[model samples]
Target chain A: MTEKTLIDARGSFCPGPLMELIAQLKSAEVGDEFEVLSSDKGSANDIPEWVEKAGHELVESREDKGVWHITVKKKR
Target chain B: MRILIIGGGMGGTILANNLARRLSSEIKAGKVNLTMLSASEKHFYQPGLLYLAVGQMMPDELYREQVSLLEPGIAFHVDPVTEFHLDENQVKTQSDRTYDYDVLVIATGSRVNMEEIPGLAENAEMFYTEEGALKMLKSLREFEGGRVVVCVGVPHKCPMAPLEITFMMHDFFKERGILDKVELYYTYPIGRIHSLENVAKWATPEFDQLGIKYETFFNMKEVDGDNKILRSEEGAEVNYDLLVTIPAHKGMEVVESQGLGKDGWVPIDRLRLNMEGRDNVFAIGDTTNLPISKAGSTAHFEAEALGENIASMVKIGQPVRDYDGKVFCFIEAGKDRATYASFDYLNPPDPKPPTRAVHWFKVAYNQLYWASARGLL
Candidate 1:
């Protein structure tokens, strides 16, 4: 079974959203999809970079209504 | 459970607020008590002081009442701590109030000691404090132009400040139409322009492009104010018309006087953040002897880690998390473009090229920092 999780890390700064994503990814199964929503611009740029560094797949990233929605697929 | 946090700076405030939110039910149930002891009623956003020196930010824009930023669950006081009794789990304040805590967090932060350099304090302009920044602003405005030497010392609180100010001043001179009159010479104590290698790599070309002259391994030995010359420990010297400096920093006086850690920085478990032998006691941010940048972001992350751990200790049996040595800093490339450094214990920062969008974000973060202290961001 696979699960898609949405982490509303809005109103958090750098490493706040990233830490939350990593925490959630710990329990998430491989191939799980995680979407993080954040208002912080630092996290938006950072999340993609982190995802790439951690060898995860960055599926899609878009901004809407002053919030960024970044989707990632857990690879490990 | 009684938790006492000393120092109302970024780390202490964030930890207190985080605990307030996380342990609210316990606080309401009379199972938890959170108290904060601070040296000042005003929480000055220290980072804004950089812009303040350059006149990009004003003095009024940098402060908030310590009481206002806290959640209702916290008991706040303005009495500065005078002594730490780690054996008895107690602290004595300037007001003669003794506080006992089941858990204690010390975030007393660091201070600039310009006096550490002979003739430097009186001769050079600085931006480490409100008064100093204001003086620098006035000095910058009065100056027609000459060689402006930015001499930096080691272990300053903000890792990027020296570079940030140097780059920002370049634009300031350009805007004032004195770009031709001023020569910018930046000096760093280390072998590289920055303590962080990648940041040094990223800045070298930028410095070249902007014609910002720099000298590495230029540790300040003394300032020959009479001759208007700067001397370095490495046997180098330069003549300057204007001297700006970022002095070496030490952790607060109370920390050192109380035998907490050498030079006021408490030795702590890097991941656990506990005072080496005392688990009930913890240190964060600039107050710790951790070999990392003593910036607000370091404290903020440490606070979050402790917040979770402390709250969990109350709700469960043990701490739930560990601090992973994370720090994020935005480097203002110039007046309008910026880049950032984000890294952890296992990673080294590889700063990307400057972008206008990132600069706007750094601008936004200046205001957002308040919310961050409130543990909202």
Candidate 2:
């Protein structure tokens, strides 16, 4: 099982959540899984799209308590 | 008394609004008349255009009707100025209308000199016009991943625009699965990414993370369109598949022809906003040769001070207000993050300093503009 990291992007807008995720991804090891939580509706959809395009893997995504939780795996 | 304003840009419109509110009260008492002359009918939210160029914003999001922006007390003229008869205290428009003024404000603004570099206007794309933005978008959409060069010509408006474009290009290619195939290069005449030290500190890391190559002290001299190359003043040649260039910016021709401007810009006293050697005449915004950033924030600040100064002159024949050369700018660094920078003659005298808080403030400020423009604030 890979180690898990959590990103709290609640209350942030588009590009904000994405930028935070990118910064975290830079320090994470390959194969590590990170979870991103965002309140911006656009990011709930945009993050997975960015992950897929950037050669990363999207593990899971869900909405709970009005906040979105998305999990991504570092592939490269 | 009659007052005339020569431009309808940020400084002109703000002054017009302030003056209208003040003069309207006086006009009812038969005290004064106000007139505003603008070359264009559309009012552009110029800062928003950078977002538009990056596909984050649409064209309709950046403009308003010119007439609607002006208050009712001021007469609006939609004509370009042909000549400034300064000695006679009159201005002749392209339509041949002559207007005399008890006081004159020259806010004619700057113009893009695309002809300075050979083949650049024809080959490279620009972001100064709506058409140019559309063209650049189309080019980006059809691009198949190659070297993209973003160059800043000397003394251009919005210094961070080239960096913003670079960030967006990085995001664009990354989104298209072509990040590996594309390379982005930023070239400028300055030593760093931005003139403010606070901004450059934050931006240098972002550029490194995005793998965007940058060259400082590189002056763009010419574009060899046929060979797909850009030559700098230092004899270095850079090859590119797509080129985005910000051409040289110059002052309005009317100021040049009337000998009121130096090197294509009107020289105004930084403290008073008054034209050099001329009393009761002022210049503001990008039109004046002020030692300040040519951003909208500076213009707005100048307009506020200028309005009060003019009002003082009207009320007591004394000009009391002073301009502080304060400038605040928001640099968008893609991925929904931006950095903010605020500088004046007193603090961080250098142009490129990095501050992360300023970037967040910029994001907040955009929301503030939306609220303010709609009069919600």
Give me the TM-scores for chain A across all models, comma-separated.
Answer: 0.91, 0.89
Q: Is the docking of candidate 2 incorrect, acceptable, medium or high quality?
A: incorrect
The parts of candidate 1 lying over 4 Å away from their true place are A1-76
Instruction: Give the Cα error of residue B204 in candidate 2, in Å.
Output: 1.3
Calculate DockQ per candidate and list them. Answer: 0.02, 0.01
Best by TM-score: 1
Compute each candidate's TM-score over C-alphas.
0.83, 0.78
lDDT of 2 by residue, B306-364 (tens): 88888778888887868876776666676456655666555543324435565567656
lDDT of each: 0.86, 0.74
Model 1: per-residue Cα lDDT over B64-174, one tens digit each: 999999999899999999989999989999999899999999999999878768999989999999999999989988889999999987657788999999998899889
Q: Evaluate model 1: give its lDDT.
A: 0.86
DockQ score for model 1, please? 0.02
Q: Which ten residues in a row have the lowest lDDT in candidate 2 chain B?
A: B368-377
